[model samples]
Target chain A: MLCFINGEIKNINEGSIGLKDLALQRGYGVFDYARTFNRKLFHFEDHLERFRRSAKELRLDLNYTNAQITENAETLLKGSDLKNPALRLILTGGYIYSPSGNFNPNFIMIAEELPTYPEENYTHGVKLLTYEYQRELPHVKSINYLNDIRLDPLRREKNVFDILYYFQNGITECPRNNFFVFINDVLITPKDFLLHGVTRKVVLEMANKYWKVEERKLELAELNSADEAFITSTTKSIMPVTVIDDKKIGNGTVGMKTQKLIKLFNDYVLQFSR
Target chain B: MLCFINGEIKNINEGSIGLKDLALQRGYGVFDYARTFNRKLFHFEDHLERFRRSAKELRLDLNYTNAQITENAETLLKGSDLKNPALRLILTGGYIYSPSGNFNPNFIMIAEELPTYPEENYTHGVKLLTYEYQRELPHVKSINYLNDIRLDPLRREKNVFDILYYFQNGITECPRNNFFVFINDVLITPKDFLLHGVTRKVVLEMANKYWKVEERKLELAELNSADEAFITSTTKSIMPVTVIDDKKIGNGTVGMKTQKLIKLFNDYVLQFSR
Candidate 1:
């Protein structure tokens, strides 16, 4: 595995950050994850745009331009032999004792084999545990995952795929994925307090052509009336949700509409990659 | 400066963590800080007890026992030439790709010169800008400071000492300190949704003997009826707060009770260190 750190290419194992780095010191950092399809980065620009927004929101200065970052990522990918490569771009508030001090930002790009979910996660669908959590500064994809990582044991113990966070009875999102549900022939996803994932954006664009899409607050009680529910992310693209907190969603099976959306998303990705 | 990383002593500059460290990857880590007075750690046991609790709450395994960590910190301090030494102990979930896998925890101790606050921060008191925000998992001292660090520029621009976080009209705490107010001659501090700072505990114990101490929800509106206000932390002990959001607290000057509490806290530290 190879990674680019501070403009230098190095083996992934050799990539290290000092203790003084604010990413390590105060968990002050932002990151974006994207995957490549057929060795071509998918929706790289969209991911970069969001990454830039996250950095700007956190007040982190990115020394490299979008083109430079893309070039560095492409160089690392070309240098690797990964079949399904995933790129993780991390920009950290660099070494400084005081927050107001002038400090350089540490930019890192890691290339790793993209993870493949079990086929049953899509065929038989997966379950999710509902948690009442509202991420701080939810719009920015910061490095803070304390709530997600700490609740992982409970997630594994319950045999759920991931935790779905709801705040004030409104379904927000999963730990790393944006959630969408179909109710009364309408597709809906929460509009506030969540990372707008690239795959989610694609699905919205595709689904809008076939079905009515509403980007608004989806309540927890609304899940009971939902005909189908699914989540989207870079890795888990349009994965179905059969059960949530032991209650079966849409008769404990993947809905026909969700399956169609998955196909549509796949076709859209194929066209984009070409 | 000297530091300890997983039982090995190294220069502070050489203390580097891999990119895969959960502290960097997901910002999954717990930390506790304590300072030494006259070359000896003050209330070391109390800080260690809190640190252990924080690690347990976060489900992070501490590879070393209390005595071992204390001894390691002492060793690092002894090797350092800092006059007023402060120790930072960090326990991070070590390198692992998946959250379910077993990970080796990284225990780190860094010795640095203790920061000295301006004398006016206590004598004439300091101002705080109130912000409507809440910390995630406020009980455990996790490394996630995204909210605090991001708001640093705002704090600087406002020329305030720190941001006072209030959620649901109740004053929670400062970014790094526990908040207290002497309202109508009775001392009050919010008991929920904030870190149980060690200095706060010491102050509560000492103030109980001299004043009426109530650990309950301190409403933001109650600040108007307050006679005096102060904040407590390991680094900033009994620092008075005379103004909050441009509103003068108790005539916008350090009150007599706050001055007495500061002297009492100083005497307590001196006795503890001896």
Candidate 2:
């Protein structure tokens, strides 16, 4: 895997900070990410749109317009080697101030090969223990992944794939992926309680054409008895969750409904590669 | 300002990232910052302490240790020809994993100079409003700050310096700084509910010697009637807030208690440069 940090390919050994920098000192920074297929990015516009929105919310001086970012990204990809890679942009809160007033903004970019993913798990099906917590920000992806990381050690030790973070009230999501439930004939997904995933948007598009999709604040009553359940993300695509907490999701198998939606989404995304 | 990206003093204009880059796409990145006073860094060890904690929490791999980071940052600073710059170090969660599961940790570092303080903000003191939201990772400083940016437009339009976040029962710190209250001879500050600021720590050190210092959870009631109120961070050492939510802070002229602490802190830090 190769990484271009501030426009350079370098050894990971020499590219890091001392313990005391301010971003670490106070958690002051903003970032965004998107991946590519066959070395070509899909929905680059959408990713950047969210990125710009994130920067604005965090007060990061990205100093690049969407068009300019698109141009640069396209040019950079023209010379890359990997068949598939993931990219991320980072902007730090200006260097350490007296921890005082107006401070200079610090910026950097790291372009690297796509990080690892559990490809097999998506296909074979995964179990989700109902996690006990509320999604802090159901609307945005911020860098504070502590909640996610907190469970990593426990999950690894237990050999589980992921956890379904549902509100005690039965609302689900606010985890690594957005969630949906297919009950009877309706494709019901948690809305307003999860990040409006880019992939979720595409899934909605697929559902609009072939299924009765409904976006509503979901409740536990609806999910527990649902005929099917699934999760969506840039990498996960549309994978079925065989179980949530301990209850079997639609006979503990990838429901036919989920597979169809995945097929539709994959086909739509591949159109970009062509 | 001088910036050392992978130990090079390159102009920021020369820096750019490929769109398909992993850092940009995954948001797998980390960074740290410190300040220079009379051409030297202050509390450098403390910054590194937090930096390491953040990296550990995020599972980011640094190419080097504390000594090496310091050396690289210094070399970059000297090479870039900047003095009294707010020094920086940024590291991205490198493209360590191939999209197909192959692994290569690609990470990089950049050290640069930025303003330590904005004269206008420090001298005149700007208006401040409470942000409805707070930092995502109340602990580790990951490179995610969109919430701050999203609230900025509303803040700037409303003529506020920074938003002070108050949860259901208590007052959190400013979106950018730790909040403090000075009453008669007792120094009351928000504890556990805000970022444990290095500047706030310094304030505590001084208060221990000059006044009564209480480090515990502070109620909103304590802030409203305080004799003096100020904010602290790595940059804004100690800034008096004359007004909050349309109310005055003490006499609102940088109370003697607040002023004394700021002076004491500066006098303690200036020793590093000499």
Highest DockQ model number: 1
lDDT of 2: 0.65
lDDT of 2 by residue, B44-103 (tens): 788888877777776666667789877766665566666556665556544444322322
TM-score for predicted model 1 compared with the true structure: 0.97
Which CAPRI category fits model 1? medium
Per-prediction DockQ:
0.78, 0.11
For candidate 2, write residues A1-274 as lDDT tens digits: 3333444544433344332333433345556667788777777778777766765655555776777666656554555565566666556554444322443444444445664557766576777766666655555455555466456665666556677776656666746788888988889887765677788888888798777999987877676778888888776777778876667888988888888887777787788777
- Per-candidate count of clashing residue pairs (backbone under 3 Å): 0, 51
Q: Give residue B32's lDDT in candidate 1 (0 to 100).
A: 88
Which lDDT tens digits does candidate 1 get at residues A1-274?
A: 8999998999999999998888887888999998998789989999999999999998788888888999999999988878889999999988864767765789999998998999999999999999998998888999898898888789889999999999999999998999999998899999998889999898999898989999999889998988899999999888999999999988999999999998887887788788
Error of 2 at B206 (Å): 0.9
Model 1 residue A117 distance off true place after TM-score fit, in angstroms:
0.9
